[model samples]
Target: MNNFLAHTFTKKAFEQLASIRNQYSVSIYLPMYKKGKELNEGLGQSNLKSCLKKVHAVLVEYGYDKSSVNDYLKPIRNLIFELSFWRNPSEGLAIFLDKDKGMRCYKLPFPFEIKTYVADHFYLFPLLPLFHNNGIYYLLELSRDYVKLYKGSRNNFRDIPIKKIIPKQLEEVVGFDFEQKMLQYRTGHMMYPAGSFHGQGEGKEDEKKELLSFFRKINRGVTKMISDKKAPLILACTDELYPVYKKINSYHKLWDTNLSGDPEFKGTNELHKASWSLIQYYFETKKREKLAKFISKFHTSLTTCQLSEIIPAAVKGKIDTLFVQQKEDVFGTYNSAKGCLILDSYKEMRNISLLNMAAINTFLQGGNVYFLEAEEMPVKNIPMNALLRF
Candidate 1:
């Protein structure tokens, strides 16, 4: 498996998910087993077909041309029979399609709710979890002789085999004299100094400059791979090299905290354990800050927890921030064209989720969304709410 699960969550990926056009669109999400399991057991494929079937039924009821409906679903039908696509799986898979024949697929490191949407625009809320709390991040372990890249989240991580931007050791890149020159450069201040070449010996400064030059080359190589990424890059290196690497790093999302040891000596699980705490803390801080903003605007018309009020505003693209209870699905249907919301009990809507639709609309319009616990919301215990832009 040559980087079978190799993927990066980048700003461009999110933009594609958020893009909207006035035409028939399809979004499908399903959990997938990654390893040591049977493939294409029919569960995921059947779910996708069922979602398309519902879309066809709706199109027929509304008097769409039979050929147009079939044309709209052709990409989906093609996907169902693609057995090769199922063999190389991850934790989940998400597929998007449109009437223009554009399609995109993502093999996720985490599982997503098994849901589907067929509408005027693709439903994006299901994919938001990848960017929201506890989502994906990167860990880059750097040293003079070795470098390793990993992509994962708080709970799990996987190595991204380094093929580009390979870092070489001092001896390998320069010569054995590199370390001797480095030591003399640092301790040249000794009273009984061994003859300084330039009296004040700018050799140490030259050694430092050389190392910085090497680091700069490495940074350029790493940038090509992760420059478009939004996830934080947590760096790992020796204590002395940290300052040097930081000065040369151009990746703006590099985390403030980092591992202070030789990361190459650490295992994947060890690295994940050390890295997750910082990632969790960063997300929690962001959530707290957003909650404070919401509370400050609670009495204003800008914030609301009313479902009836939020549904229309969401459809109209007025939501600036939304806080919804995690893993709690609300059943209903939303007609974006009419701004109509018909709520039914969870048991009644079958696979349709109105809460997800509202969130999806909000995200498509470039709104920030937080999937928070009930207590973390401005209005505690409320299942759904939003901080409106208007």
Candidate 2:
């Protein structure tokens, strides 16, 4: 079985792409459908054909022999028949090919709009969403009969195999003996009912203490499993249980906002949608704080919105953080040797996006990029903005 959960867009993958110095590098981004006829085999083949047609045009324009180009793309063509690969679809797929690099493919956790970029170096900005999406978060659903754990991102959610480490039910951990013990406590120590279907010999306070003890045990196991992964954990349970869980939670990165109500009735899609809405605000607020600092230090020779100056600085590893409009594109070329930018009319360089180059270069140099709405940007007139390291 494939452990897709281990897949990550690592720094080594970025270095490999940045080092490719090929004459005809092809970058293809395809939106993948999870199911139906679109996912079976036909859609992947059709998309590859469409992308190849575009690549063929670029090769012809650059004066490459048709046979040589075909040979370079042959491995990619054969990948279309890998039924097992096609069956396990994520949100998107990216394919990079060249004469020297051969062909490499990545199944992304987030979807990309279908597009093709044929360039001298591999076009990499389309893969940024995998990094910028803040990766994954854990969701713990609590209840008497249905305690479940899930591994989730903004676009996908799946159950985590945690039954072995953490017990999934009250009976599994405390056993049926607690029921008779609770009745004894209630008859001897309490003057009123404990307010739920399940009861024993204890008062409400004692019962609550027992439940807290159970939750703390679960939390310790969960923390041990996810401590190395620093992703946020969100708790989903009833309103009454939320406070109890929060009080006992030892995980440092547990999200303040939680999924309230019983999660047993909720579908994966519904839970993911709600969780994403809350998590997005956390990401945006973090970006805003960084952007605000950039604005404050603009006069210290460490911040800029000038495309001409920022492009070369990004190439030299000076950028610390960047904020750019999500879908905006600018047509131009950069001369890395002399740190010069050559802007062209839209009719001249239709395929090259200078904005994408800036973002890609920044990421390659270990800088951060935030895709903000127009209103959220520090400057609305310029397409790019950055905070410099030096």
What lDDT does each candidate get? Answer: 0.70, 0.75
Please report the candidate that would top lDDT against the real structure: 2
Q: What are the clashing pairs of model 1?
A: none
Model 2: weakest 10-residue lDDT segment is 1-10
RMSD versus native structure for model 2: 4.7
lDDT tens digits, residues 1-390, model 1? 111123445556666556666455667777766554335366766777787787677666555678777866676678777777767667777777764546677787778887766556666666676666676678888876677788867545887765645464544456677777657545744333221223344664565567777778777767777734788888877766777788889988888877878888988778898888768877666667767888898889999998878888888899988888877767677676776677777522123566767787787788877887666667876678788898
Q: List model 2 lDDT by residue over 17-54, tens digit each.
A: 87887777778888777888787647976887888887
Tell me how far the alpha carbon of residue 87 in candidate 2 is from the true structure, in angstroms, after superposition.
6.2
RMSD of each: 7.4, 4.7
User: Over 4 Å off in model 2, which ranges?
Assistant: 1-8, 34-47, 78-89, 133-136, 155-160, 178-206, 228-230, 297-300, 331-333, 346-353
Q: Could you tell me how far off, in angstroms, the CA of residue 82 lies in candidate 1 after the best superposition?
A: 3.1
In lDDT terms, how accurate is model 1? 0.70
lDDT of 2 at 328: 73
TM per candidate comes to 0.64, 0.80
Model 2 lDDT, residue 320, Cα:
91
